[model samples]
Target chain A: MKPIIEITDLYFSYDNKNLAINNLNLIIYEKEWVAILGHNGSGKSTLAKLLIGLLEPLRGTIKVNDKILSQETVYDIRRETGIVFQNPDNQFVGSTVADDIAFGMENQQISREEMKKRIDKYIKKVRMEAYLQHEPHLLSGGQKQRVAIAGALAMDTKVLVFDEATSMLDPQGREDINTLIQELKNDGDKTIISITHDIKEAMLADRVVVMKEGTVVATGKPTEILKDETLMKDCGLDVPLTVKLSQELKKYNIINDIYVNQEDLVKSLWEYSLIK
Target chain B: MGIQFDKVNYLYARGTSQEKAALIDIDLNIDLNDFIAIIGHTGSGKSTLIQHMNAILQPTSGVVKILDKTIIGGRKNRDINIVRKRVGLVFQFPEYQLFEETVEKDIMFGPLNFGVTKEESAIKAREALKWVGLDQDLLQRSPLNLSGGQMRRVAIAGILAMEPDVLVLDEPIAGLDPQGQKEMMEMFYNLHVNQQKTIILVTHDMNYVAQYANRIIVLNEGRIGFDGNTWDLFANYELIKKYHLDLPDITKLIIDIENKLGIELDHKINTVENLAQALVQALGGANHVR
Candidate 1:
């Protein structure tokens, strides 16, 4: 499959002194759900900003959908990609949910009729149709984030980047967005690059990319990346609880299989005890 | 007694078109040296409820008593500042509240405002910094130059310097990494255990609630949905689901194992370490699997 986003030799610096991203190269395939996992100041957010053209890289080339991203094509590239930030209050501009969803469409010079249809369709997609008329201040953090997602989806972007969008929400709110992301993935056309430090959230992705000090350290399937305790620790991350427990069981010679899901782990343990 | 809320009700934008009730009929009593975890979904009045502990937001129709002071709704209380001194409420993202030129001065600011002398406040600042595990070199450095975790520690140290009887925190580890989250939670746990301080934490992480808090309070739609220990809270799956709450990952895994095996396990097993031990026993001892 042709890659959707291609980055080579990416380097970014917040100040003239320290490099935030250093010699990073990544390729995300079409329709792939890629999770970028890292600790704070690991350059994951910097990479996301660089990909969406929010922050210019010191040295790198980013190509999106067969088009090389440059100063001239940056706007066009951004139109094909949308990002949801961590803070819902910081991203929300419109007073109401419908207006917020329409803000993105209006920037693209979409017609009023088309904007209405897109807002209706995308808000429903995020299960926020009931909150269409609600003010942004009144909505919960999760609801505001859902509206933010709707705003991103309304832009018709092929690649959606969530920059720790669920970090500030409650557990239920985080679960809500995770459910929405799964639904979006089921559609199988849009590519998702979620930048987060959440291990459980990262485990749900199709591929996991681990970063440390502004460079890619590991990249593979979720189970492969998360099962390596030392590697995860090197990247300043903790393995999921189930994975940790599975390792404990392995130490006791109870189960040999690496389990990521709760049910799978329990079922394997049950079988192991019954066989014994 | 540490704090009490008697029939408290809070209304946002009261008597207007946008009037909304945030907390309704809250009656709670928090004892000294108690570690309490408040769990709820967003918009469930968790923030509104905690603000009342320190007199940050007075009750609209009830009374809030902190220590020996009583703050009645719709009435002026001259002793509000006295109540505030006894309870230190740390808001979410507290690092953003730091504005001092140096870490030491920032931590000292809280104690000085509470009427501690300059010399005593300076001593308290150093003690607080040491308590939070910050190096002495950071005392002179600007807080803005520190890392996210360091800045968070500085802000938390500022609160600790106040030496309040009740420490209220709102999702104190919201954006921290897994390692930082563990370290910060452990710090608070130590403070609760060693200092014997009343710790009231508002968080969405069930794992933290299970691991740290002995008493759990569940809020649903501005009402007390459930109030009990962690074991009782986990056993009431229907109440948990109705409030859109979740079980700790280890607890959920243990429950799944019990259901699949059609056997009963100890409900007291909340932590991963304890659950692993319980599972070993349930499987007929450690050597049975081998």
Candidate 2:
């Protein structure tokens, strides 16, 4: 439960008049998967930028691995953090998947032999070893994202952020990425932050932080945060379908408690059905 | 006027080794005022099919009749602009294409390009703004300075200003939040219901298809795999699996509950409310539960 990323009294504004991140405070523990939910212009992306040293905060501090983010330590901070963005077409820098992955490690002054070995190991980890030589343009959106995740993992960063990563993908592609995230969580070694609009994606997180008007409105377990329809609406999100069903059943006294996951809810309903 | 596509075949990089067929033997008859949802996997020729609606990409070996215009493959056609003006195709993430300094100017740009008078285009701009549920005060603001959701609405307003008969939206709500997605979908649905505008939407979200679209057209590998009512499309579990399509979340939940509880629930229920009612009835009636 060691804090890996700590933000204190963070403030940032793009226009110098309106605050994008207003007095925000948060701490992400090591090996924790936190999903940040917010509507557009709620400053989710700004926070992601500030964390990896892409944008300097106007006030307060962001500490990654206990090192405060500043001009001098920005490079050191960035080396330990990696981010995969929304658009897959814009993130490619190499002619092939293998080269794109090696590009990051090479910047760290890793030797050719070690770089090759790490690339091979991480590519297989993300399940993209078969498409090692495929061009970026030839790969599907889901495949490109897998490669991106592979690239980030290849860097051996402690903190990995996905900024609306699966938003642009198809359902199957999204499933693949979500599965990869689950596997990464099971490994319990890297801290993952997913900023997404999909409630199903947030349901997979260890913690959920809901933002509205550039500030944290609610923070708790995904089941607790997502079950409150009012808070979800305030943050411009819809409750997941399973939760809605459970709530309705609860009102009719058909079920005693609300369930977030599909399987558990269905199981509860099945047990209830056997009553009569 | 409706659109008619006849055995259309489109090939990219034609006559080269790199040439690939993007659309093949496509025949579709889209009536006026039809709300159709086009769906399939990525790279399933959905984009290529919609691009033909506005002559953005003409077919290689077939005929396309849009409104009063006819485009024949391998033949000279000079009315591409006329077809484009009548069938407005909004690309995915269309906000990225917004470059005008002001929102008003951006919306008017399309109408002005089509030879509308400045005064007339201004009027159209305000009307289009209303259509997309934006305030008139935003007219003077820079399009780039607005939030992502506003920028997207302004981009759609640009298309509406053109007064197109057929509105084709490509993944219009892909990156939007849950509420933004609901708002945009409602806006399109209103345009279809109240304004009598034809909406041909391309989306990966079957939830929207189940809720809004009356008709569904599924494409697979540059060909039409299924074309029919939404109910008929979702009824076949095998077809849905074969196309790698996902059911609406509510529908999926209902099917899961039926299987887990060993009860027969209606597969046509697409909303949470209806699903709850059905579940209660299946699990020994609401009266019995009470």
Q: How well does candidate 1 reproduce the true complex, by DockQ?
A: 0.55
> Mind giving the per-residue lDDT tens digits that candidate 1 earns over B1-290?
77888999999999999999999999888899999999887778999999999999998999888888889987777857867767989999999999999998999998898899999999999999988889989999999988888899999999999888888999999989888898999999899888887899999888888889989988888988888887788877787778767888776777778889877887667667777777877887776425
What are the lDDT scores of the predictions, listed in order? 0.88, 0.91
Candidate 1 residue pairs in clash (backbone atoms < 3 Å): none
lDDT of 1 by residue, A128-231 (tens): 99989989888888999999999999999999999999998877789899999999999998999999999889989999999999999999999889888899
Q: Give the TM-score of candidate 2.
A: 0.98
Best by TM-score: 2
Query: DockQ score for model 2, please?
Result: 0.72
Candidate 2: segments with Cα more than 4 A from true spot:
B287-290
TM-score of each: 0.93, 0.98
